[model samples]
Target chain A: MHLERLDFRLQLRALIRKELQQILRDRQLIFLLFAMPILQLFIYGFALSPEVDRLRLGIVDHAGSSISRALAASLVVNGVFEVEESGGTEAQLARKVQDGQLDAGLIIPADLERRYRSGQKTRVQVLIDGVDANTAGIASGYVGQILAAFNRQLTTGTQLPGELVAPQITFAYNPGLISSWFFVPGVIALVLNLVSTLVSSAALVREKDSGTLEQLLMTPVSSLQILLAKIVPLSFLLMITVFVALMVAFLVFHVPFRGNLLLFLFVSFLAILVGISIGIALAAYSENQRQSLLTSFFVNLPVIQLSGAIAPLESMPEIFQWMSLLNPLRYYVSCVRAIILKGVGLEEIWPNVLALAAYALILLSLSSSRFRKQLK
Target chain B: MRRVFSQVTKEIAQFRRDRLTLALAFFLPFVALLLYGYATRLESKNIPVAVKSYDTGTLSRAYIDTLFATNQLVPARFRGSDIMGPLDEGEAKAAIIIPAQFSREVAQGRVADIQVVIDASDVNNARVIKNCVIAAGNYFARSRDIARGRQLIVPQVRLWFNPGRDEALYVAPGAIAVILWIFPCLLAALAMSREKEQGTILQLYVSSITSFELVLGKALAYTLIALAQAVLLIAASMALFGLRLVGDPFMFVLSLVVFLASSVLFGTFAGTRASTQSAAVQLVATTGFTTALLLSGFLYPLRNITYPLSLISNILPARYFVEECRNAFVRGADFASQLYIPLALSSCALFLYLVTSNILRKMQLKG
Candidate 1:
């Protein structure tokens, strides 16, 4: 028994050493493992503030009056839209739109000042490209509302001003609509995937590269032992990577962690293991590095959509939502967001935990079988 | 003409024998559609909500009852809890905290504001729930006043963009980007991987097929495919949806050319690096499919990330394509000109080609 235990320990240690040597040897693997994540974190966190502001607009004031210029000035003062150039003809504004030089344009018709003086209703045409419907929609409506509100204040009509005014709009949750809240959690899930999915495939490719894979088969190490040895070390490395990532998110990105740290760790562990196992299983059949990377893409591409990381599951048509159930990342990401951001405990997050655990066990076992079969 | 025809026929026969290629070519679009349809919907309906009622009085009870009557909540998954559990688990989007003094405040004709604690993790979901919560509150106010024979609440002007919300104009340009990313990868994946399979890729070094020639030939093939796919996709989208060609098609195609050039160049790099068909497929999915969808600011905006990472998105050809396509097709951007996305994409294509050539020259036959 003592000899067997020692033998097992030696095998496990040897397998881990082999995996590490292969990963460290390759410069590309090093970049994928370390540089990519760090670069993305810094680049995405600092530079990419999705808070939509500073829209560039081209304006053509047909009347060329003080009122229109004053209106344009209010838009700039609000910091919502910037007038890149002050004066442009109607055709020039049209040209700007065509040239992609402008996000929007304001064309004040010939009689804007006259219309305001006559106390008559005037319609301002806001032309927008329907492509990128969301941005266009938001910009056009915001400009329209702001201008109309300015108009409303000036013209107190037959209907009382207060009556025409709607109840004040209060955006809850993210009142300012900070896009980071949407991106950060999704990125955390994705970055974790980089560790499990990307690394597992690379690790398998490394074994294939170094020729230790066939050598291991020549030895008496159980396929399951080899699989566990390969996974546990990588999982440890990934856990450290994930922890560091979370910390960066916490400190630098200001991504809040409201739940139990230990529970979060446990849940993330299960999720990462499942991803690694799936990658390992896929990697087992690959004959070369190219094949393994291809496996990673085919497997990982579907996961992004299937995981409810972007789309709300319920909103998806029934066939698609059912398809989402197969995505283990969906459960893991849900659990991560719940625990880390929302501070939900095991009681609420248990469903995801159970699903993830099941996934991990199934995937690891399947990968072990594939490894055994491949070796044979 | 006959020799060229026979060569083309031979290529066709070669393609027919490779079941993987056939299967992928046929099934990829269907797969993409299903994936996009299921994965990318931003709309949130049937948002789950948990209601904790501390209100037992008639007015408060009426409000609670009206809340249940609202459309936004999926159903009460949990009965009552303080702010944490349900929202934390995403079991409920909003927790309506109806306080004990609720009826008394209403009877006194004073404004009683019940706090609605929402899980703000999902901004869009939270927005929908907030709308529902407001509506429920308004319903309570209207009902309470109606009982006393008073007109308490009235509808008001909500200045929305385009006046009427149009969904068609929104999805067209993204489709153009999607086509640009996929078509080139398919054609380029085949060209490089095929050469590797046939042992002819090595002949580039033997013969004088410059690295530029290889990239250009492979890219030219895929560019044709991307162009064809663009026409079909654009025509189809416009036909299915009333997507008018408000902008210049020429500008759209020009931007697409830049996008495809970059994507095809990437495929060449990927195909060369890959030792097998599966790896080529995987590389496309990872670099082409995944990055194009997410990092390119297509499905989600690049601005959502921190600076330098979002800048990395600039290298993603689809980012430029999405921007330029949206400008031309939906925004009615002039076809004759537009510089930014095209310039960026051309630079990226040039860079990728240079890297492809450099790497190709240094290519090792074995990994």
Candidate 2:
């Protein structure tokens, strides 16, 4: 029994060594393992900001008075709205917006100053393109805020001679509404998913495509040991990437980590497992490297959408909401958001934890079984 | 010429036999289009909100009525002081706290503030909610002003092209760019790398086939397939997502052909450098995928991005394509208006194809 155990240990060491040598030899793989994560970190950290600013505004001022000009000037003061073109006809302004040259148009009626002075309400029109639903919605909101502030200025000290209602707004958690803070958590989920998914499948299928996998199978290692050997090196590389991503999130983006460190680590590992399992399952089913790649794209596109990465779970259509329940990314994304942003513990995020665990279990088992069958 | 024709024919036959590659080439673009179209909805409507009204007064009721009427907020009753319970459970995104003195203060013409506590976990969603809440408050305040026989300045908002502010218009064409980018590039990158990895590239080198003929043959075959996919995606976007082709159809097709040629040329460049399928895949994913997602201005406007990122955006072909698509689809801009973009695109295509062919021919001379 002791000799047999010793023999098993020896075989395991050889398998691991072989895997490591292969990984180190491929300069491209090493680059994928290191440079890709760091590049993505910088890309997402610097490039993508959810905060909408500097929207192009078209103006048509038929009022031709100080009040109408003041409104336009006030809208531009916040730096969120930039006046692209001024003093155009309303139809011309609308055409500019339709042509995608401008995002929004403001139309001040001809009788605006006359009506305001005569104790009659005058409506000023603000038209915005809604093609980009998020930007459109936010632009409209910014317009509202600008209007409310303008109304307050009209009512406050210089005194418009009329009372206006103003809402006292308090933004909980992130008061500044920093786009990076929101993105950091999603970025963590995304970087980890991309690394784990691409690396695990690519590493496994590379061996098969090169015929090294068959030779490795001929050795004393069990099918499970070979599978474990295949994943362990790649997963370790992926874990290093996770650390890199976290460092970038904390140090560069300055995303706050209010939750327990240990819990965050634990949940992240669960997310990594989820990525690896799905990748391996796809790899096992695919006959070649290219097929596996196409499969990965097919799976990843849906996974990203269902994960509530960009489109919130609350916003997706009803059937898609149901589909999101099965997406591991959904649970991981929500869990990380809750942990990082809300600083909630496992008690609050248990559903996501349970779902992630379930995904790992089912995917790991399914892929391993398929792998074993193929080996036989 | 004969060698090139025979090589092209061989490539066409191989492509047909590869069922998986063919399916991915012909079918995946539509699938990706449908998925992205259905998934990306930017309009923030029907936000679940908790109404914590302490005052049972007509003014407070009016405020609540105005909030619901905007169609932005969907009110759910907050059970007493446990407002955080609904918010923590993700049932409500925001809570409107009307203090007990709300009616009294409003009635007496005093500044009565409605406390809007927002869960700003998602910055994008939070902005939408905050704006809606403020708009609702302003609407109520205006009603009060009119009640007192005062003049108010109201703003009327209008949206054009995508008047309904449908996200499909924003996402569908962008999705087409993404789909075209991935499949065609991968197909071309893998075409040559597959030869190398299978040791068939050595056989081609040994045979009488010149390097120019080989590169042109593969490029032509893949370009035709990619062009077909592009057309399918364009048609699918129109039929399903209502993408209006308002510009010159001829110019649109010309721009597409130019864009596809540039992409395939870049793919050939990557394929020639990489000796294995895995390396080629890695190269394409890192360079192609990352550039498309990051530098293409697909997700956000190029102008708002910082100096370095904006500079990077200039080098990527997808940025120009996305811009041209928006102009064509929305503004119906003529060829003269977008002349420089296609010109730049075709020049890049010509340059890359020349470089790739030169490199391959040099290798042929060496062998």
Candidate 3:
């Protein structure tokens, strides 16, 4: 029995060494494993911001008065809108908007200053391009807020007999609202998900495609040991990627790692296992690498979408929100976000931890069974 | 010409034989469409906010009522005096604490301070929460002022193009652009890399067909497949999202053809560059798919993308194609006004085809 155990270890070690050598020899795989995550981290951290700013505003100041100019000036003061072209007719501004050169246009009427001074309610027309419904909504809201502030300034020192409620808003966790802090954790989850599934499945599918799996199966080594040999090395490599990604998030993006280090790694490992299991299942089902990749894409896209990695779960419909409950990545993202951002421990995120663990356990067993069947 | 035609036929035959890939090409986009249409809502709605009212008075209750009245925030249950507990536990995104003024300060015409603590982990969602809560506060204050008779400058705002602000109108076209770019590029890249991997490109090298003919043949075949994908996706979008062509159909059709050709050529370029199918897939995913999704102004506006990255978007064909798709579907502007979009798309197609053919010609020479 001791000799059999020794033999098993020798075989597993050999398989792992072979896998590592193959991975190192493939420059593209090495790049995909290490470099892609950091590159994606930088791109997503810097470029992907939902905070709307610097909209191109076309001004048609027909009034040509100080108040009208002051109104347009106020919109530009906050850097929300930059006056691309000023002192044009409303028709000209509309044409610019139609041509997609401008995001919105503010038309100041000829009597705007006159009407305001005479205490008659003045109306200004703000035309917004609503093709991007999100930006357009935010722009209109911003215009409303600016106009409200302007109105408050105009109506200041006037005697009004009413109560005022002041809401003192304080942003916790991330006071500065650094978008990268929000995205980096999510991107880390996304990169890990993509790499784990694609690399693991491709590794297995390549073996199957080249008829090497059959060669390996003819050996005395158990299929379980073979699968373990494959999974262990891949997981070790993926964990290193996680470390690299986390370092980038910390050093470059300044994303705070507020929770327990061990807990975070454990959860991340669970998430990676979930990804690998799904990949192995896909590899076992697919006959070739091409089909494996296409199938992985088919699986990965919805997983990423429903994970609340890119878009928030609160924003999704009720059905999708409930559906996200079934997504393992959702639990991972929630845990990661809580740990990194909110500085919560396992106590706070135990449910997510449990869910992730369950997924890892269930998927690992299922995929291993399928893999063993395929080997036989 | 006959060589190119025969090559096209050969590719289509292989593609048809791969029933799995053929089904996925049609089905995956439909899944993406459904997900993008329903799942990708940037607008934060029904954010859970834990409201801790220390004052059980009428005014505080009314203030709480006013907060939830907009339906942007809903009350979340939290235990004890720990205001941050719910937020920390991920049960609520924000917490509202009403101090024990007993409505005395507000009744006395003083500003009643309500402390609002928000989880700004998601900066975008936090911004929405802050805006919603402040708006609710402002409304409450303004209504009181209005009770005493006061009016300010009321700006009449008009939402042009998409007045209803339907999200599907914006998302469906962008989804089409993204789906079209990713799948076709992926398919073509795989096709090219498969030949290289299987050592079949040597046959092409020995054949009388010129490098240009081989590239064109492959591109034409994939372009036809991509065209079918476009038709199916467009038809699906219309059926699913109730989308109709609002602008010049001819401009839309022209841009779609140009965009598909560019995407397919791009795939072939990556395939030719990468030695392995995995490498090609990686190339397409990292460059083609991510850029098409992010920098193409599919989810975020182009203006919102910061500098340096914005420069990358300028060269991306997907960006221009998405613009044209949105124009055709939502804005419905005059064809003349949006003429530069198709021009830019066609230029991109021409550039990609030229670069791909150059790569193929060099490969042929080396062989």
Of all native A–B interface contacts, model 1 reproduces a fraction of 0.29
Q: How close is candidate 2 to the true structure, as a TM-score?
A: 0.92
- Ten residues in sequence with the least summed lDDT for candidate 1 chain A: A158-167
lDDT of 3 by residue, A205-260 (tens): 88999999989988898999889988999999999999999999999989888889
Give per-residue CA lDDT, model 3, range B1-367, as digits (tens): 9999999999999888877678667888889999998889887778899988889788888888889998878988874458788888888999988999938877776778888889998888888888787777777777655633244567788998889888788888999999999989888998999899888998898778888899999999999999999999999899989888988899999999989999999999999998878678888999998888889999878876778888999889899989988888877777898888889888888898889888888878553
Error of 2 at A202 (Å): 3.1
Candidate 3 matches the true fold with a TM-score of: 0.96
Q: Classify candidate 1 by CAPRI docking class.
A: acceptable
List iRMS (one decimal) for every candidate.
Answer: 6.7, 2.7, 2.1
The true-versus-predicted C-alpha distance at residue B201 of model 2, in Å, is 3.5
Name the lDDT value of residue A88 in candidate 2: 78
- After superposition, candidate 2 runs with Cα above 4 Å error: A1-14, A86-95, A107-116, A120-125, A151-165, B1-4, B76-85, B147-152, B202-213
Q: What lDDT is reached at residue A350 by model 1?
A: 88
User: Which of candidates 2 and 3 is the stronger one according to lDDT?
Assistant: 3
How do the candidates rank by TM-score, highest first? Answer: 3, 2, 1
Model 2 C-alpha lDDT per residue in residues A123-203, reported as the tens digit of each score:
888988765666877787788667766765654544443344557788877888887787678877877887788778877
Q: Could you give the fnat of all candidates in order?
A: 0.29, 0.65, 0.77
- Shift in Å, residue A94, candidate 2: 4.9
TM-score of chain B of each: 0.75, 0.92, 0.95
